[model samples]
Target: MQRAQRNSLRLLQWMMAASLALPVALFVIAATISYTSTNDIADREIERTLDVAHEHALKVFETIDRSLAELNEVVRNLSDDTIRAREPALHRRLKRLTDSLPQLKSAWIFDADGKALVNSLASPPPALSFTDRDYFYSHIDQSIGTFIGMPLTPRPPYQGARFFSVSRRRDSDDGNFIGVIQASVLPEYFESFYARIGSDPGSFFAMGRADGAVLAHFPRLNHDLRLDPGGPVGQQIAGQPERGLMTIAWPSDGIERRIGYRRIAEYPIYVSAGLETSAIRARWFATMGQHLVFGIPATALLFLLLAFAFRRTQHLQAEAAARREAEDALKHSQRLEALGQLTGGVAHDFNNLLTVIRASVDLLNRPQLTEERRQRYITAIADAVARAAKLTSQLLAFARRQTLKPEVFDVGQRMQSLHDMLATLLGPAIEIVTRLSAEPCLVNADAGQFETALINMATNARDAMQGKGRVIFEVETATTIPDTPAPVSGNQGFVRVTVRDTGIGIPAARLGRIFEPFFTTKQVGHGTGLGLSQVFGFARQSGGEVTVTSEVGQGSTFSLYLPRVPPDLRSQRLAPNTAPAVAGSGMSVLVVEDNIELANFAADGLTELGYNITLVDNATDALAELIVDANRFDVVLSDVVMPGMTGLDLAQAVRDRGIGVPVVLTTGYSQALSQDGAAGFDLVQKPYSIEELSRVLHRAARLRRVRDGAAE
Candidate 1:
């Protein structure tokens, strides 16, 4: 009987081993499949995006080449003196052509002396000598067809926009180089197009010249950025010359990527697209994790049933692991809570704005409203729109996109002016105090952003104090800052502004992360956590620093340090232009709007402004009307966001077809306008008053007449 029992035990041991081995083998096989599949998906996606980048690069360069050729042909036979004499007309022509192409930043024609004779950016190009420029030097030596040069910022007097030159050598009849006809192509244009197509995390798209000059890159633009010709991408081009794929660590950032590169057809330009290897591996891990979630639990269950001998030991281990998992889950939940708070806070603010707009519209629709009440409702609607715009602006500021309009101002005086406003904002429960410097505390910065930052700090103080505390605004000159805590004595060139609050201070653990976006100690409904981040970004962007010191339950002090400017350098602020609107005297307008009601509203408004109006519901119809008689309308007023084609497309069509009418675009908001910026056409923002619309339309109409007169 003992021998029989031993046999049964051995049989049970074999069954337990089989159960464990089978599931383990299946799990390994499944994981292998998932990893391979994920890598394949990543490869396909990278190659597809590369193909798109390649096509876009090709199209852009080809258009630029065509523009250069046309420009060359126009000026090929003209002498320098003759070109200079005809520069006014040629300047207009260049502007017209350059505006039609969104990729072109500006166009220029240079004399043999390397002096710009005409440019699209201005009526007469700035009298800057370009003899030292690489583009000019490249053509001065030889005729290389279209020479693609490295990116550069235009010299002073020009707005600092980075551009890569696509230039053709202008030759005399005897094959001697005369000058260069150059088109400055915006790298941001290519980056914007790449962004629209979308990208995964760590995905990269770049357009570069064969000579290692990086013309454009997504995520950032640097005029001095370049690629090494000896790198993997370049070596692949050398071996393949047309197109190929490889895996390499990017020399610029040391990131391992699976890269696909293509050389533009017979041109000295190459485009590369890459997907991060780490991202690919992460995807593979995620897929396998899902499988393991189920597979491991099932395997555990099978093991417990088959091996009663080890069941108690496994149970104890699982209980210990469960407690560890609970801790990890709690940490993960805390992180998710911050994201939930941000989303809820943004939604709440936007909803409040929407509520005001909706209620105001309802009130305005009521019958027999008094003119004063109507104006009040209209004003309320306008205020809501402005507030919503400001909210978005703050978000953009935190994202580091807010364009600062810096000017010299006295920080002390500005703070003094805001004393009453601060008291009102903080409420009667909170006492407001100011300790401004008796002397001037002048600084060059964006006054609006500074005010916003101050308000953010004040509101944070109010929240910290639970709406009952003392808030102090102090401005003074500092010889040293936190960054240079012990500067030499009397080196006083920094203006320091402090906002100190008597309130419950921040915890040491959380203080370091206060400036991070979406991280806040406040409850979910109380804050969006973007205010402090905006303040941080504005400080950094303005060439300053903001530092805070806090002790738990002992109040907090926030200090901002900005470089002080001399009193003599304080800039004069421009007053608002409040001139009366110019009436349209029988001018004809073609109004294109997708919304029927809006189209009628605009037509009626223009008609009341003494203009003849023809309305259409889409860009296609507007183009048809222009095609029938482009000269009939003095200005074409169109909504930017439209069906079948955008108002931008309509404007381009008008220009491309040599139509003489001026196109004025209107929009509340549009991605196209934000990206390419009206493409040199006049733009009037929506929610415009009738007077404002009349002024814009009249201005465009006047330009049309002037152009016609110039032609005559």
Candidate 2:
């Protein structure tokens, strides 16, 4: 009886051991199956994403190409010699063309002599010549369907922005080539398009042009993310025509991700999609856990019947999960790398603008003037200085360097006040029209800045007309919602003020850069190219935007959109105050300036104004004159930028020598000299009318007297 009982116990122990081992083996098999399934899904998702991204990218490229084609067609039709000779009508057509296609910067017809017959910009330069351009030479063949020129800076009547020119030869019925029709397109158009791909939160997209130029991206990466086609991924990209999945470390973010990249076969750009490794693994892990639960029970039965099947399933799951995670990480990195390159380029251009403003201001203060014309000279000098100050302010705003001071006001009323001034400024040749809304349109903005912007727009319109054309000013109000179609490109809800002109229209080529500072189509002395730039800065600073539309001949329109302001906060209008005059007790003054003609003119004006004047060309001579007889000079008036010493330096020197005379610095460029550190000195800007100069001098004299009295 004892032996039989022991045998039963041993049998039971063996059975229990088998039950536990079978389940463990089955669980391993199930986990392997789950990982394989998850990997397959991940691969399929990657392929789909890549395919979709490529298709979308191609669509964008095609749209741009179509726009370019339309512009080329317009250029071809307008380049005829007969059409060129017809002034006003030919100009109107060109304006219409540019107005219809806002993307074009500027368009023009170059006659056989390389003279511009028509230009869409404000004023086509006199004696304009472009016979030496590569596009003109290449188009001479006439066989090239459409000649696309490399990126270059456009010559006058167009400035501030770089553009690529598209040209086609225009021929008469006799197969004789007349001229080349060329259109300019801004690089920013491509940048704007690429910015709209997707908002996948943690995920980002990127595109690279054929020449290894990183075009666009999402989640704004820093400058270091540029992808070099000579690099590993770039090499891989070159080799593959179809969609691909790979693991890559994006140079910009330095994060490893699973990446899917596809070359846009029809276009010159490559599109990429990226997924984080953590995201992929987390998804796979969840799927694997669920599979393990079911697989363990099933595998236990299978292990009892077949042990080899369970071992194979376990191995497959582990391998699949690792592969998927690696691929996703690589794609994310590449996209970021491409984005960094584009941002860097934009930053570099912005810095260049700052440099130009700084240099121009320093040069303005070098010229000399006389006492009588000092006030007029000072007013002209002040105008330029003020613009320079505005430029720095814009940079600060763009960089988020300054705090905003927004206020509420009626946009319509403000525009109405500007209309009278615009009418006077645009002149008789250009008909001025107003289409203001009857109901008031409120907006939040800086009133003084807004007025300046309005004036700038009016001036731009006047230039577009070349002293003859029609300018239509209109204002309207509307509420905006998310995803709604914007009235202008890259804009949202705001008050829209449209300034349209029937002058020479902007070409599609030069349309994008009209707002860039120093990018002007006017002759060098005719315009500073800062008009639209100031408008852009003011709009942006006030939480608004400025968009432009133009055609080569049809015309150009600028639309300013400002955020709506509540009624209660509008600024009260202040009456213009008359400037107080300085009560000089027949004191002698010293005037220093480098330009002889201006200096002589100023001295004559001051003599007429009953002031005794001693003129010098620079700060050194003025100081010498003062040292020879300190009592001879009541005040030292000097231009800021000079060869020997700056105006500020001279002022400091005079103070150190115990000369108690007042110093007034005059300049054309004020950006460098208007900072807080340089604020104590009196300033007068260049290009001022005679009356304006007198006002500033009087104020300076009065301030000096007050200071002198306080010292006594």
Top-TM-score candidate index:
1
Task: Give candidates' CA RMSD values in order.
Answer: 43.9, 51.7
**Weakest lDDT window of 10 consecutive positions for candidate 1:** 483-492
lDDT of 1 at 408: 86
**What are the per-residue Cα lDDT tens digits for candidate 1 across 1-712?**
3355456666667778877888788878987888789878887887898888888888888888998898888988999889889999999999998899999989999988999989988876778899888888888887777888888888878885788898888889998878889999898998898787755787788888888888888656543667777876667778988888788887667788888888888688888887889988888888888888988898888877878854543565567568868977997896688667667767888899999999999999999999999999999988998877777767666655554556789998889888889889999999888898988888888788999999999999999999998988889997667654532323346788999999999988988789877678888667778889889878776767789999988899999888787777766573333556667789998888988988888888878778999888889988888899887888899888876799899999999999888898888667556534567887765566677788888888887778878989
Clash pairs, model 1 backbone? none
**Clashes found in each candidate (C-alpha, N, C closer than 3 A):** 0, 75
Please give me the total number of clashing residue pairs in predicted model 1: 0
lDDT assessment of candidate 1: 0.82
**Each candidate's lDDT (Cα)?**
0.82, 0.65
Deviation in Å, model 1, residue 430 alpha carbon = 99
